[model samples]
Target: MVKQWWAALIAASSVLAGGEWQNCFNGKNLNGWTVKVTGFETGQNPGNLFRVENGLLTVSYSDFPNNSFKDEFGHIFINRPFTNYHFKCEYRFLGDQFPGGPKWAHTNSGVMLSGQAPETMEKEQKFPTSLEFQFLAQNESGTRTTGSICTPGTYVDVNGKTIKQHVIKSRGTALPAGEWVQAEAIFKNGKVSHIINGKTVIEYSNPKFDDGTPLTYGWISLQAESHPIQFRNIQIKELD
Candidate 1:
């Protein structure tokens, strides 16, 4: 059933918005983005954690003093928010995990969806109130799958049941590190879906805040958890 949805969506991937896809990252710089890392004010990029390198928007830890990441979870958000759209990107995990980060964050990063504005987050807020389209790669411990959904401060109904758990694994492909994988999300008309490498892994609907308000739209951001990762070819297309 999910495969059927994937086939339909990817078929429409090329020609959405009149055969035009909006390039989110200009590849030269982070001009249309905002940085919000915990323990730092908005726009203050500590340790040069997020930067443009080799024409890719990268997350690295090469500049941290004393090899400490300082647990400053970070995110770079597009300045403009979206309501209904298709977002796609290619991501890959890189070298070692920085010190001072939790084990769970190793090779772990995510794309924040329906998120609050960068400026609205607290100085020490761990994560924004949003739905996270999670990404994971293999580590020494074991193999992990990508495309799982994590709800930081929201809820959704999956398979006709309300799911309140924090993170739910998807029936996604398990690939190793160092390989670039395609990740995507579709949030249209109060329905949500996650796709990985052209496979539809999870689907849900009725996203609502803890306060019972329907969450139809918000900002989108890429995560900078405690790992070395790079993102490229980030693009989005609005659905009507």
Candidate 2:
């Protein structure tokens, strides 16, 4: 069933308005998306955790009770499954990490691809089954890179070898927290590539579930990993 859906979507290969690339985000509101967050029922955004202002989509925490970050991880998902395309966006960190958020979560967020639909996720599920293009800021220390891959409930083969570890580092350089960084992922069949700022940093193939089930197509989601982040210029280019 899933495989059939993947094939149908991939075969469509629709071009975006006026060109080969389509702007997934309309830059005004969350129109073609769904929200799922922990500590709240699915689709219940207690705070304006996901909002757009001045044409920038922001994940904020100003409205949570006590204005504290309470592990309320969230995802804003594009409303469909996709395959064989290049997804790209620009993002930057903003403000300090809300109190009680994990130290590692400061300035950390991701774009999750090949993920299950928001309706299928458990109410308290921490993450979806997908490949995460983990975006990290320099945090002023200047050692963390932005284009790493974190597999949650999935795995991928890289360099002809299966990596048992969860997070795979990319070769991209890290950028400062305040700067908008360009992050992208290209997918064809089961092969995936992560690019940061126009540089190809990671490449892997044969993405599959932990139980060895193949993962060919799924939803695209922007993560709210307990931080304030902003994303802009979200677009995709369907490939042949």
Candidate 3:
């Protein structure tokens, strides 16, 4: 009876350990990711652009010097490629400004999906040729809202209606600045979904770019576009 109980306990532990919420970021190093761009470089060991703290993977921009901006476009992309999966993360607006930064940088950041080769992007290119799950904060113009889709080279449709504009129509009420929000993207069977705080903010299908080409799979990346943003709880589960 004692041996049987021990075996049962081990089986249960293994099942729990193999469940969802697997840590993508190693937390101690950039082992599973690749960085591409000029003017910017990874930070100190174990605690850099992507760090693990208190069981959370934090993408921080605080360690770099204030004058670090020298047109240094940087991206930390997942080394592994994914085709159909559900990705989710928790993000917070740092509200910190950099010297000589763009005026709207405070409300700017995004997650690039179906992304291009990081090395293929030209040195002067500002963004990747992929679909962007744009994360925005409340701004003076009121155009920056969370859960909006921005197609760099792709477009989405709603209810069979093609979206002519680059930006999608906002789904829920705008979230105030300086708060953490949960964001999720479901990519399966040539469809995608953008969800915010448990609410389906945007749902569209048949994502393709301006050239009328379909995106089957690509790397996932996070942007540090002249603004301070932090992301945690980054995880992805593969789909059949």
Tens-place lDDT per residue, model 2, 1-240, is: 343344444543252223288888998889988999986776777678899978999998887665676678999998877767899999999888878899989889999988888877788888988999999988566778779999998889999999858999988877877899999999888999999989999999999888887887778999998778999999988765
Q: Report every candidate's CA lDDT.
A: 0.84, 0.85, 0.67
Clashing residue pairs in candidate 1, if any?
none
lDDT of 3 by residue, 32-132 (tens): 77776454433222125555556555545566554555555467787656667788887776656545556655657778886776655666666777778
Q: Model 3 Cα displacement at 239 (Å)?
A: 0.6
Sequence-dependent TM-score of model 3: 0.78
TM-score against truth, every candidate = 0.90, 0.91, 0.78
What are the root-mean-square deviations of the candidates from the true structure over C-alphas? Answer: 7.5, 3.1, 10.7
lDDT of 1 by residue, 68-110 (tens): 7666899999876777889999999988888888988988998
Report the candidate with higher TM-score, 1 versus 2: 2
Q: Which stretches of candidate 1 lie over 4 Å from their true place?
A: 1-19, 140-143
Model 1 lowest lDDT segment of ten: 1-10
Question: Largest lDDT belongs to which candidate?
Answer: 2
Best-fitting candidate, measured by TM-score? Answer: 2
Residue 93, candidate 1: Cα error in Å is 0.4
